[model samples]
Target: MIPTPYPLEEALGIGWYITDTPGTGGVLRKSPEDFAVEEIPLQEPSGSGPYLICRLQKRNWEHQHAMKTIASALGISHRRIAWAGTKDKNAVTSQYISIYGVEEAAVEELRIKDIVVRPVGRNQHPLSLGLLEGNRFAITIRDCTAADTAATVAACTAAAAVGFPNYFGLQRFGVVRPVTHLVGRHILQGDYEAAVMTYVALACPDEDEEVRRIRTEYRETLDAKAAIAALPRHLGFERSLLSRLAEAPEDHAGALKNLPPKLLSMFVSAYQSWLFNRVLSMRLADGVGLDDPVSGDRLLFENGREDLVTETNRRLVSVHLSRGRCAIAVFIPGSEGARIEGKSDERMAMILEEDGITAEDFKRAADFVGLRYNGALRPIAVKSEIQSGVLETDVSLAFTLPPGHYATTVCREFMKADPRAMI
Candidate 1:
């Protein structure tokens, strides 16, 4: 099995490449180029029973940062910013920041420098988390080569005609995704607080115990193999055991058997990431990236973006390409099953049992969606050019990936394209 997450195994392992070189220049997502930046302006009524005007901007400042910036700006707390999903950094992005407690009459008028305020209808609560419907993109890829410009346009035409591969982009793994795993271990331990502290909060000027521990431990000189061995041996493959106990801890003895499964899973996932990275790195060493863009290539960006997905409870989103023989129809889980009279009753029994969802649910979900998970590898191609030696063309072609997947794994060619670009 190619170590890509189960969701993308077929697409990743299929050997294919589509040209990434976009046309000389263009608006929106033309062939060969994806959105350079995404922006949105959020305005929701503060769920505090009355409207209280709160404001926001990108948390990281210079460009589109994390989706969490919305929470940071309003001082409403990161937990409050309901986003459809996350966006890439290092690009220009602008998204909405709705305020609570503001008068219904005032929402149309509030304005800030880069932040825009719009009045979304009243909400019993601030938008629930992960509530974006989807997003529209405004992309830009500059610095086209005079020699390759014509060829680039042809490639874009081909890509549009053939539909670029729906491969995940590199951003799936953060600047240092490996770390998210090692420490995310604590989160699995049922210490969500620790996971947040160690993974996301350590970089903050204000550090916590978990943050300090990770920083100090990580800073100390150590080898990867030794580090892996040093991890708590007691925490091995305990997810099932611990999760079972978490579901039923009425007995002290049984509950005691539960180790920090959440933390361990974090470790497992991180270690998985490490393993994939090493393999990817080895592939690069074996001469993989020559035909692809290197990580050190020219970097570009635009502004922030707003959320497009309006809801998430039960969503059926289908992304059709402007060109090519590709498209995806995604649905929220729980819509399919075996329909032999009593099958529905049996399926309902499963849902009521220990497992939150049933196999029948998955089957019916697929049936209702009307699209088979055919496991076809999407085709993608990329090209790179060096001009005037000013550090040009570091861009690539990619797709939106859900959580728990590696963007680099999809861009295996690109990762191997330049030995130095391995995640």
Candidate 2:
């Protein structure tokens, strides 16, 4: 349950530090050449290890698509290939992919469309999620004037000194079609039929005209079989879900189960992300300091440690915050071991009360689709290392951010354009 039925648009419209900073209005990801990312490995790979880590550069490839391609070339199942993070489809990105029980020579020989693989080294363990320290981004903002570049540089410099708000970027929910949170809400409420319709029939304006028309037809006719036939082959998720519905219209949960478990879990995570964004917005609106700690706030340090804030410990926490070694943290609500309590607890409770839900509601979601709520603390603001230089008509900016932080969150402050359009 949420106070409001997952307001997708409002959740995305979070605040920024330099609200009036003139934007370097330009296009990002105009081509694969425009945006680039390099994954920063957690540590140097051991020369003698069980896993082969391949450094790959891919152009215009979705994360899962790239995995499947690599898996096919390596003669292994997709699950055998693991990555640190999922890169965007619209960018030219470089990252390390690990394959267990694969030879170094075979990995070096593997090639896939739009992917360049180099055998970097080997590691003793698979590159699990959040294994990377951060990502290095070299993004080009096209068609910008000197003034635009100056504004962007100033924002970046200021952010380097004073951390920026850590709102989850638009991509976390959805960029093209912002309905992941909506579908998640329906599923959490145990309305599987609503979830199916939200995933399959809700046409988004941001999508292409043909896509909108197809979704519109499906919503109007309630004909799953016809809709599945009309949808393009690339829309495999939609096709499979609709095909299930066609066979048994009442089997909503079964239809949803047709999607990959990881992808299905993303819907639940999207909803949690939306709630955090909403609460973050409220806190900003209330004039709370983005990086400053208050009594009852939870303070997290860089050494993977945290302390409860109180009058007795506020001074110690302030010292850490001043040194840029710690930050005030907030929680994404979950059951038992997941939920956090302190200053932010009141805010979380208020939101839960407004939504007519308790923390216990999240526990019930696990009963359907294994949507377990694994909660964690996230900083309200994060420090970034930014280096910007202008070249001809384009402004190139390079920066590194911690794992789980969104680079777009920092860029949006400078660009002030549609975050989705930029990516």
Candidate 3:
């Protein structure tokens, strides 16, 4: 269970690593050109291999959509195409895609909408999840003056010197609906009806006007047929759920089962990520250092060293701490295996209590199979190398971050405005 970092909004009321630094007013994602991302592959494919490594530069295209397009163009199943990570749909992203049993020539000949496939070479391996060193980003923030640029640079300097909280950004939880965690809670409680209803009917206040109207109708009537008609074609998942309900109506479990298994799994993960954000915020509020270690906190060695904490070997931990080779680890709670110990454990327990859930709740849910969280440790803080340049009202930021860290999290620190407002 690896921690995945994704996007943010200001609705969480979360604390910041450097709370004293107020953000400068800025705009983000004004256009697809505003955010550019390039994935740093874990390793280059060897010359001889069965897989074709393709470097694709896609603009305003989601990963799933791109996969479908590539699969269709190549006349292959979608499962044959693999990528290291999911990139933002509203950005220009360059990533490596490895297709099984495809030749370099065929890959080069392929063309897709808003996507340019550049055959990089071949390797014996297919790109798998987490098979990336990190990501490089070039983000342009508009509506900022020179003074605002200076303030942003100051924030960046502070973050580079002392790391920032690695809270999963608003992207992990849906930016449009923010319902994944809500649905997950119902699944954990063994209430498939509530989960299905929450996903389909509960309208978020932040949603677009037309979407809010349609959701309101569904919420009031619970008429699957009508909802399906009202929903746009882009709302494929919602329509799928509603279609199942229109057929069975009474079998909530069946309706949930109709959803893609990957999506159902994401609901559980989104819930876990939300809880992690809460715990990390609490840790900061409790005066815990993001970089420095406490007696009970776990320290994961990112380098090729043994995983060691300050519990027993304080002297050794101190050495690694100075070198930034290790991180203060926080567990994203699962069924049982990875709970933190001592003082940090108490903080997590309190957080779980607030949510009316315990570690046991993370075990396989009665309604969903294989949706259990096995748990993993995430660092409290993550580092990024940021370079800032200004062109009148628009400010450009370039940086590279390790896997499991969000660029929006870094941007939030500099532009302290509501994340949604910036985007």
Which candidate has the top score in TM-score? 2
Model 2 Cα RMSD, Å? 3.8
How well does candidate 2 match the true structure in TM-score terms?
0.88
lDDT value, candidate 3, whole model: 0.75
Give lDDT: candidate 3, residue 184.
84
lDDT of 2 by residue, 1-423 (tens): 012122443655354453445667677888987888888888888976888888889999877767877888878887788778878789989888888898878877765778888887888888876799889888888876446577656656665657777888878777788788878878777788998999999998778888789999999998999998889887778888999999998898999998866678778778778778777777776677776567878777788797778888778788878887888888887655343456467777676677665556667766565756867788888677688877766777788988888877777666656555576
Model 2, runs deviating above 4 Å: 1-9, 44-52, 72-76, 100-110, 119-125, 145-148, 337-343, 367-372
State every prediction's TM-score relative to the real structure.
0.39, 0.88, 0.87
lDDT of 1 by residue, 50-139 (tens): 433333333223222332333344444433334333444443333444344446455445443444445545555544223443333333
lDDT values for all models: 0.33, 0.76, 0.75
Worst 10 residues of 2 by lDDT: 1-10
Cα error, candidate 3, residue 47 (Å): 5.2
190-303 in candidate 3: lDDT tens per residue?
Answer: 778999989988888788788888888888888889888888887877888888889898888888877656567778777777777777776776676686667777777866
> Which portions of model 3 show Cα errors greater than 4 Å?
1-13, 17-19, 46-52, 72-77, 100-110, 121-125, 145-148, 304-319, 353-361, 365-372
